[model samples]
Target: MDTTLVIRAKDVHMEFPVKNGPSVVALERINLEVPKGQLTALIGPDGAGKTTFMRLLCGLLDKTSGELDVLGLDVEAHSQEVQNLLSYMPQKFGLYEDLSVAENMNLYADLHGIPMGERPERFQKLLEMTGLSEFTSRLAGKLSGGMKQKLGLACTLVRSPDLLILDEPTVGVDPLSRRELWAILKHLVHDEHLSVFVSTAYMDEAAMCEKVYIMNHGRFLGQGTPAELSAIASGRCFEVKPLPGVAMRVLQSFLLADSRITDAVPSNGAVRFITTEPNLEIAWLVKQGMTPVPVEERLEDSFMILLKDDEQELAASSLVIFADSETETAVEIEESQVPKSDTDMPQLDYLHLTGQTIADDAPIDIEVENLVKQFGDFTAVANTSFQVRQGEVFGLLGPNGAGKTTTFRMLCGLLPSTSGVLNVAGVNLRHARTQARANIGYVAQKFSLYDTLTVYENLRFFGGAYGLYGDALERRIYEIMDEFGLTDKKDEDTSQLPGGYKQRLSMAAGLIHCPKILFLDEPTSGIDPLARRNFWQQITRLSAQGTTIIITTHFMDEAEYCDRFMIQDKGRLLILGSPADIREQVQLPKADMNEIFIEIVERARDKGAM
Candidate 1:
């Protein structure tokens, strides 16, 4: 037992048995050491056992075989003690929506058995640290996504545990708030001497940590400081100037398909890639008419290259075994057993989504003029106006509570606007909300599928809702399932599917009717890099096939996939343009989307705008 380390795992291996198939290996020969008073990051593609390992540390799941220690205590032998010595915040931190901020903190304090005398000082400090001091009276449900996360963090800190284990803490948060949370963690490490272990989808966040561990296929790929990991691709990275009129995503897709390239992604108005063979090949570049410019590798570049080299992706289903029966039977549950989600859903009937010849004149598909939505005395969205052209991918971006969702809902015709001229697919939204929705497909921020249903059943239900029945609907469902790579898992239980598959299922259902325009709200939020890449490829395909796409995403890299993007802050549209245009507007033409976004938002705040 090393007293200097907060967590130490040696020869850790976790496996779950399936009654009818081979046992699922969640972790294999895992070893780790987290020194006291340091921040450690756990990053991997989806179903690489990140959350599983974190759960083992928190004693939420018992490890199958291994020596696990937390604060010098054997976790398996003293599960309760280990839990009491640390705080574990899962991705979905439980916050009572009906409870006020102060009330939520109090509830957590009660759960952790914090002394009443120590509650006030701790609560006050946490509130101030999270920038939620003035919102103590606000109900948790009323808070923005960022504020809700802050409140969850505050609640977790009520007891001042020795270690903090956070799983994907900034998954769906906006850029600004994500930075804020990291700042808070750094402060805790330096000022309060707290040891932290966290998982995150953002590579930039992992780069900020003192140590990073990359995992794939339930095994470790590499572990080191950001600089050390980045060195893996030191001589293999290059930025290619895209051909004229070629979209960045299209260029990325092309580069990725080549056998010589390990990975290629959108980067600051260019396509960045790593070669399977070392160094730049000038002859190859010449043949393709590409000007190769060598560039330094970031932590993400190393991660993607490593994953590709590993040649494994748990893209379809999670490996975790859910015991129902010895024959691997599923519990009898209907689609109604799951809670309902808000997706206008994909429809193909009203307007053609099937291989239609896109007209040369790309007319506006969505036109929003003077859009305004008021909730009591508060303006959820101001007089906002924007247009999305036919077959284009447009992105809407903002911090939490900045009215991104309000605008999205308006466009989907799920909510009526207080004042605005909204039109979609040539239909006036204000006058024909239902009719407008018929021409659009929607996949919300969260996975909008019935977990209790099978993949095929969920699609069947949604297809029927959209007036697709009999062979036409059935054929469309199969076509979509195959298109999104869900055909093999058509009969699999939806709830048991991996996070990435759920994302695919959501996408497949939304396109069942092949709606002319698709609205995706944070579709790739919590999924891994591999899953995001696949999702974007589908989006790119759809855009090329002439389906207009309007999406909102916090991942700047994903935003780069857009043909044009609109930035909103405090219910006001701040900027709208292509990646190059926005970068130039922010005086950061060479910076990435993340840099440009922060600059634009910060300038807007500094100008004293709400």
Candidate 2:
């Protein structure tokens, strides 16, 4: 690799003072370099300081210590120049919701001082490239989640800068939108020689980058190509399929029990375990009389190993400098002993299946017959038909731009179907929009709650809108607040809560009126693993209470919670079945849901289903 660097940081550190005394280290001794014209990815879990680094590179934030340079210019000394040369897309890039699509683009162009002569050409090209030509008149706030993201990207690309920095650009985007975004990015890098630095949690996206920097705890753990990183865990991973209801928790317990196992993570009904020792055999599994099958090392498995190694290294460093002998002894003692509760303990009801049942002969909660939606010459949803049984968790699975959102809008009475019949809760959505909407609740892909309103206020407003009032509404709101652990934050503004809590509030608001059916569009996107588990618990509880849920998610493992699902591509339905049934239909020897989804989409495309 060439040593010429466009961006460099040496021993950078950033610390923010908390309320009390101690400080929170956002970045510590971070060292990274981005060669000109290469795509460099900063990959890690949430709160790993990827955003902090991006801010530093773009001269948006000052480092507490150390040196930083972009394009041979000091970040602190030449902030204006760096800002001129770098284009940044923050996690929440300011998008004017009130403006039309074209108006927003024009606003960006004027702010950037682009020449009038170049503006028209650039604007036209961008519109054509991003497929936003026809939607120019649409209000930014009215666009779909994926469309909004594309618009954001287009706005940032209006000017040709030396480097482009995107923080979690595809975080909550659907698979199709993700692919489209990547395609645009790849084209820019290849054709325009654009130097791209992006942060992502998706392992597949990381694999496609020219180089990757894996970070944890505000520090870089490793830097390499995807193949090089996976090589670190070669021949050390094993896949285990335990009995029903035991796969995930059992594997988690085993990883906690055995120090030899560097990592254990759940993936589509199985656990992938990685070990560092080359000669380490599966003695632990054999002792427990369980069988283990060797499996290929994926990028996620490699990331897990890297995280574990980093954790151990931190532990060892702490031990070496400990001043108290008791503390060191405690560390050693804890390392040698596994928690008693983890061994042979029964698994919690992770699914949280509540005991509520809808009438077996109840009318279908949602029915779509010959539904179609069109945009000029493009058909988004074409003659799609399905029925969702009452009390069932019906999943809408599809690649990006598969018309899922369009279909969802029609069902919710937010959009008029081009043709066909649609019914929700025994009411035709087209003609009886008010009655249909009253019986259904919807959670959009983005955070749709008021940012300035307190949690309690938001709940109160939503409850009131649903005809909830007086003491009854107050009582229900309090109950929900307690149930979701948001009672303490009831007075805090919705925007002030963390991402997880905000998600909980959104779910709570959707269920405040106890509608017969709920619609969730990618509800768990950008949520952490632990929070995702809790969110699923809530979903299970709702299902048990006889609420029909129609949800769409890109997280394949979540499909296991659905009663049945349909996978769509473009405007066509590809497959419809339960999670297990879909797996079986794929017919791959060891394929999981993610792999199965990939296979089905690819096959559908080959067969012209799109």
Candidate 3:
């Protein structure tokens, strides 16, 4: 291995015993060389051996077979030495809620046995770098999600190790924090010459790395610099504008069902697709009364093409995806049912199941007037007002601690408003909390399922709590199992299921009663692109069925799927409108949601409103 390589691997194979079944292979003959003083990324979906590889590199999980080296030391023999020379930040970094940020930083320093004389300089540098200096006195639990992640990073870097390994560090964080965290990593790599290796589901994050390794089913699918890999998608990528009278999702689902297209997803109000036959596809697009536009190849596009093994079923076309979404079942339509003209496009079999909501006459399902929530002297949500129409996919977005979750909880009937009028499913939340809850299905930020329980048992518990009984509960449980493609995992412990399957089961439990309205809090957080896509497809299907969906997400691109969305900060509404409305308000009508969100939030901060 080259002396400059920070870590090297050869023929790495990892497997875990599965009790009653054969051993499960986590990694297979993996080979990788991470360069020093640079950023390297491992990209993969859940159960793609990413976490397994990370653990092996850290010597936390012994490999079945492989040669692994970290900083020129054998990880197996000098695990302590390797661990001492590097920092590892897992998805869940333990931060003591009772301790302040400064206390947490000191705790890590003590754990690493840093010299007392050196503590001051290291803590100051880390605090300034993570922008947590001002919040040092704040308890870890009091910090927002983004701030907590920053504190965690600061703590991890207390010893200033030569290398840093992060597994999805930015998961569930807002765009602003994500950008800031990357800045810290880039600063460390370029200025301090620290080697940073990370695993992330975000393609944009991977594109920033100097080297990216795409993995799936425990094997390397592809590896290269971002630009080098992006070149693979050249000429295979193109965009098609939605035909008149056709919903973007309708066209996307239609395209996803076609085997001719390799991948198709909604972006910036149009459908971006990959196909081997670009010219033929363009001609086909034109004949469909849509304009085909050539687009630049992106790392994400190439990534999908490489990890085609865990490929989303073409039958699982999604209405929206943070990265990708595919659930098990497909809503089938007869070939003859396909519309012959662009104007007749909106009428489809799926649309019939969820009567097309393009109409403006849909009844208002959620109405909040001057909604306010306060704790002693602090206002978590103040004077926030919004309305969601029947079948509308409404997005609630904010920076960490921005009160979107507070508003969501109010609407879900979990938290009683301190004051103000709140109505859900035509029931005044203040007067009929239980009735409102009965009509609403809520999926919390942290999935509210018992990990020790099997999928079947968890469903039964959630259903029974909702008053489902006997054959009604049994039939609904099986139906939901089939709906989310979880029938095979019914008896499996929830903890043993893959991240994606757990997400499906969580959603199933929420919708067991087929509630009139569904509330999802950061539903797509920490999952892979494939799972995100599948989750959104289900949301899309439900919305089409006249199910009002109220969701909060840190993924800005998902705003496209929402009919309307609201952004709040400092417990106040900063912006409220559709994607177009937001872009127009930010004077970036053509910009994506991330840009719009950053602009709005920063502008609010600048105005001292936040």
Candidate 4:
């Protein structure tokens, strides 16, 4: 290995034993080298062995074979020496809920043995760099999703190490916080010459790194600069707007079903697809009055092609991915039923079996008027007013600890408001809490499920708790299992399932009683792109069937799908409108929702509203 390299790997292999099954190979003969003081990225989906490699480099796990080196020390031979030279931040939250932010930082600094004379200066620098100076006295548990991630990073860097390894540090953070976090990393790399190796699911984040290693199934498919990797998709990437009457999702699903199309997604009222079929002739799409338009390649486009190629090879070799058990059982609607013409685009009855309707004159499902919540003289939500019509998808946006979750709890009947009116399904949540609770469902961000219980048992328990019994409960459980693509994993323990499957089961349990309204708090956080897409597809279908949805997410791109969205900061409603309306209010042309969000939040802060 070159002396200039900060990290090096040679033919590394890692395997884990599975009960009564073949050993799982997390890494296979991997070879890589990272030059000193460079920011590198490992990009892949879930179950791609990214965490395995990180653990190996941190000396937390010994490799089954091959050599691993970090900061010129063999990880296995001199584990302590290597560990002392690097800082590793895992995916989970690493802060103490009971301690204040400043307390947490002081604790980490002391653990690193920083001298008392220098501790104050070091902690101040970290807090300022991470933009957490003002919230030093706030408890860790009250911080927003993104702020927590920033605090985690600050804690990891208590003392400058030779290397910094982060495992998906920005998993569920909002766009504004994400940009700020990356700016911190870029600043450290240039000013202090810090070496960083981070794993991420966001393609945009990977593009910022000097070099990116594309990993899949525990092996490096390719490694190169962002521009060089993007060249692989030249002339092969294109976008096609949906026909006059077609929905973006309808077109996306249609394209994805074709064998030639490797990947497809709905983006900004159009469909972006990657395919080897150069001619781009789809008889079905053509008959439906659509044309594909050529577009420039992106890092994400090339990365998807590589993953799809690897997946095809695995299928050809008869190798199964145990983590994706539900892939084969996913159901797709037929083309004829997917709106071939304007007249054919009828309202999809997703809950026809249960007989739900979304009338044009449907009454408001949720009504919050001048809502206020206070905790010991600290006002969490102040004078908030909103209304959600039946079958509408409403998005709630705000910075961490901005009262978004607080308002969500009040609307769901979990918390009593200190003042003002709150109603759900025509029942005042503060008055008739029982009736309001029965008409709605809730899915927490962390996925609250019985880890030790089988999938069916959890569903049965939830259904029974909802007052269902006998064959009715049995039928509802069966329906949810089949609808959520969980029939194959009926007996699988909740904890053993993958992130996507676990999310599906969580949603199934919530919907077991056919609630008219659903409250989702950061429901799609930390899941891969494919899983997020599937989850939204289910939400779209349900919304069409008269299920009013109230969702809060850090992902700004998802806001475009909602009928209306509201942004709050410091317990005050800052903006409320449709996606386009919000963009127009921000006065930014050609800006995505993320950029719009950043502009709005910054403007609010500038006006002393934050």
lDDT: which candidate is best? 3
Screening candidate 4 with a backbone cut-off below 3 angstroms (N, C-alpha, C), the clashing residue pairs are: 144-400
Candidate 2 off by > 4 Å: 1-3, 15-25, 92-160, 183-193, 215-237, 241-291, 302-364, 372-380, 413-439, 467-479, 513-516, 527-534, 537-547, 555-561, 569-572, 583-610
Q: lDDT of each prediction vs. the true structure?
A: 0.83, 0.76, 0.83, 0.81
The pairs that clash in candidate 2 are 176-400
| lDDT per residue as tens, model 3, 422-486 | 98989999999998888999888898899999999999999999999999999999999988888
Error of 4 at 517 (Å): 1.6
Q: Candidate 4 on 1-610: residue-level lDDT in tens?
A: 4668888999999999999999989999999999999899999767788999999999999999998889998999999998888999999857998999989988888888878888778888999999899999999998887889999999999888889999999987878789999999999899999999999878888999999999988999889999999988887776776654344544555555455676777554357888775545555555545667777888888888887777742221122111122353232453444433334442333213222223347689999999999999899999999889998888999877788999999999999999999989999877799988999899988898999999999999999988899999999998889777788999999988877788888888889999999999999887666566667767766775678999999878788667679999878899998665686778774576777887888898898944
Instruction: Mark the 10 consecutive residues where model 2 has the least summed lDDT.
Output: 322-331
Task: Quickly count the clashes in candidate 3.
Answer: 7
How would you encode candidate 2's per-residue C-alpha lDDT over 446-558 as one tens digit per residue? 97899999999999999999899999999999988866768888899887576777887898899899899999988988764434545665665566557899999987767
| Shift in Å, residue 142, candidate 2 | 9.4
Which stretches of model 1 miss by more than 4 angstroms? 282-284, 287-289, 312-360
Higher-scoring candidate on lDDT, 2 or 4: 4
Candidate 1 global lDDT: 0.83
Clashes of 4: 1
Residue range 1-610, candidate 1, lDDT tens digits? 7899999999999999988999999999899888999999999988899999999998889888889999999998899999889998899999999999999999999998899999889988999999999999999999999899988899888987999999998889999899899999999999999999999999999999999999987889999999999999988999986655667776665555444677777887888889877785634444546688899889988998888778633322222111111111111112332112212211222113322333447798999999999999999899999888898889999988899999999899999999989989999988998888888899988888999999999999999988899999989998888666677888998998988888878888888988999999999898777667667777777887778999999898777888889999989999998887788877887887887888888999999655
TM-score of 3: 0.94
Error of 3 at 525 (Å): 0.2
Please, what is the TM-score per model?
0.91, 0.73, 0.94, 0.89
lDDT of 3 at 106: 86
